[model samples]
Target: MFRRFVAIVAFVALAAALTLVAWPQLLGLQRAPVLALAVSFRGAAAAAALAVAVVLTAVGLVLHRLRRGLGVLALLLVAFAAAEAGVLVVRGVGAPDVPVAQADDVTVLSWNTLGDSVPAQVVARAAAENRATVVALPETTEGRARQVADLLARQGSTYTVFSRSQQAGIPARSTSVLVSTALGRYREVTADGDTVGVPSVVLDPAGGQNAPRIVAVHTTAPYDLDPATWRSDLRWVAARCSERNVLIAGDFNATIDHLDGLGPAPGRLRTCRDAALATGNAAVGTWPTSMPALIGTPIDHVLATPNWRFTGFRVLSDDDAAGSDHRPVLARLRPAG
Candidate 1:
């Protein structure tokens, strides 16, 4: 009886785990708690599924004599978990080859500097190395943004920086956009009277022809501390993406899966990570520098309208060494002709 009870409990637990992994949004748990678990599970879906499968297999082996029916049920659960894991692996396997960027391609880089622990020089060097035309920094201040631009200028690369802070003058948290002089000038786009607390700016092309309306954004992280505000902030950014030719880049604090609610159909933003996943170079994880990238949730992103084609995407390796908890994401794009 004891062995059968243990087997039943294990089977139920495994089933619940698999269900959560399969459809996280369906879970009625609190938004923040479920989202946090989903992040880890989604980042390593195959692994999570496989672990459950292994547990089920062990349970089956142990209960083969005590309850033959329970043993068969456990075996079935193992098969189910294996199938789920296979599906995840198939969807996540990256493309074998991604085309290189051309001179005509526009490159954008986004990174969260973790309260300015990364030096301006490092940021500048990374931008130059990646040939980034636009750079978005979250958790950065106006002064630091200018300092990075200055470093880039010293290296013969000129960029115009636009920054906005939540507070006027207290070294508060901020978001910044750095547009290369080569990409023409840009202006700040403000939210008229709304207070979702996300910072953004827009870049209007020189002749305003064929260039994308570039927007840099940083949404709040979804946690118990402020999940409602975080969701609202994401909705605001999503609404902005509904317009044509808008390309947004920054730390969204939510994944592609979490974006189902931010919709009105047809005008939803697409992530550059999709292209990377297709090309086998997706940054499976982009947070908490301590964990291997495959296990970390990719929160930082470069998103664009359907009119643009993503040629290449990469998450910079220098992020961990620079003391930031997030990795830098860079994407190369070309207008769909």
Candidate 2:
């Protein structure tokens, strides 16, 4: 019976496809083509699979001859949705309240300004409110960076600001950093290497103040840039983590799922560990304010070398109306030593 053979083949193919979507790392396809895109938004994928299952179940009830096979496929889809949802729950969809910065603690804030669509004043206010000692602004230009520094200074928080761009005077091409003088003065410096599509700001401590090297990151999104370029940018961001005593933060454009095998244990990048995962909110997404926090992509992050310990971390979704498509991420850390 050709019909029976066709049904068997269809079932096998659908199962295989769902398996890859459920866990691409099963085939090491997490970083590969379609799988990479599918895994980027686990919550969304689960919702999609569940919707399809519901539709299939309705159709199966109406068409008697196809009922059995359709019901089986529907069941398989429900299983896939459950599997994906389970991962999010395990990763944690909500973060608990984090303590505010105290003496000897450094608070870091990262916000992609969407090429300055979000004003400098809003960014300054968030930084001040968080008592952030270091701020990373991706998709923000030099001019806006200076404005943020000035606003913070007026609020009695003086910072040394540095920004870099793939091209001069282009907001979307730039990334910026502001380091509080509380830590010590810092200066803009060359990265060990370069990102292919956008700029990331790197800083070195002046006079060896024991301040960690910092990178304000901005790797291009995988869907927006060519695969090679996206991979190249991620590599550059990872390389930034390889140095000792470093603080890296901002829109990395890739999740821990994609970063697997690119680093060591509990590691999100090289020797650095993700603050969100360590603090139990790794599943809370930061991008696409249009999407729910639990359903969007958590491509933004704050990560640090082994020498630092995360005291607290959270993704701020309350600012979804703040003009940027991205939600800001905040983290507090203190020296392990």
Candidate 3:
């Protein structure tokens, strides 16, 4: 009876661990009471597993001399499982770097111009006012992208880079990069696959001087429910920015823990938060121009590379802006060691 009880407990513990890994989304959907309990003791899952391993090992040694080897093996398995669980905890509690700018500091702004009669003007106004060195406009038609680019250029812009299409794989949806005259001109890198469902622009800021490489992208929406899609988009971005001092900015439909009511799950794949945290930069939330009832689901973002530094950031929601459903966000940062 004692051995049977131990076996049952061991099975339950092992099953729980697998469930956490396979259905994290489901875990996020739990009710408040249970959810709080689950999150408050997330380590319990791993601890239970370890405890089972130790118990089973002890039982093996006590029950039969022939099982002594199995007992040792069980102990080793416990150690391995504990280590894996610890690594995930570390990953969740991310420790991102926060570097300082050297000399080539650049400011960037990214917004999803909801198009036509939305709030494009407000975003544009903010960008102009902020004097952002790099700007990314996702979900933009080629014609409108040119229109905005031209408007900014009239103010004496030097370089504007954008795809003529709105589709990602084919380089549509018009991801544009407009640089000030001081930054000089750059060559556009050819985009390869449908990996990034949105058109992304890569800017090599190397104007005889070492400027940080900037890639601007817009990701697929409803990203919270779609890991495969989100992963594909991120991998595409990673591929595009495989090298150099990189800074990625755009309407990445996600948010950080800085906002309340948002959860562990929402915070995990939040493109903006993850990107900024991964690169060790501070970011401001930008989204929901209509300011829906939630008022807290920040879905847009700007993220810098690990070597880059974040000085400041903000969101613009002036009623004067037009052409989008999202507020524009401006960020200032510099490259570091």
Q: How does model 3 score by TM-score?
A: 0.57
Report each candidate's C-alpha RMSD, comma-separated, in the order given. Answer: 4.2, 1.5, 12.3
Model 1: per-residue Cα lDDT over 1-337, one tens digit each: 9987987787788776666655565663323555444544454655654576567567667766544654555565555556545534544534333356676678888888876778988888888888788899987888888999998888899998888777655432677888887776666655432225556555566555566777777876776554787777766776666567767888877755566545532123432224444444543567867877766776777777767788877776655889788888888888778
Worst 10 residues of 3 by lDDT: 257-266
Give per-residue CA lDDT, model 2, range 95-149, as digits (tens). 6587866688989999999999888889999998889999999999889999999
Give the range where candidate 2 is weakest over 10 consecutive residues by summed lDDT.
220-229
lDDT of 2 at 327: 96
Error of 2 at 177 (Å): 0.8
2 or 3, which is superior by lDDT? 2
The 10-residue segment with the lowest total lDDT in model 1:
264-273
Q: Which of the numbered candidates is closest to the native, going by highest lDDT?
A: 2
Off by over 4 Å in 2: 224-226
Q: Candidate 2, 100: how far from true, in Å?
A: 2.3
Instruction: Tell me the TM-score of each prediction against the true structure.
Output: 0.80, 0.96, 0.57
Error of 3 at 227 (Å): 5.4
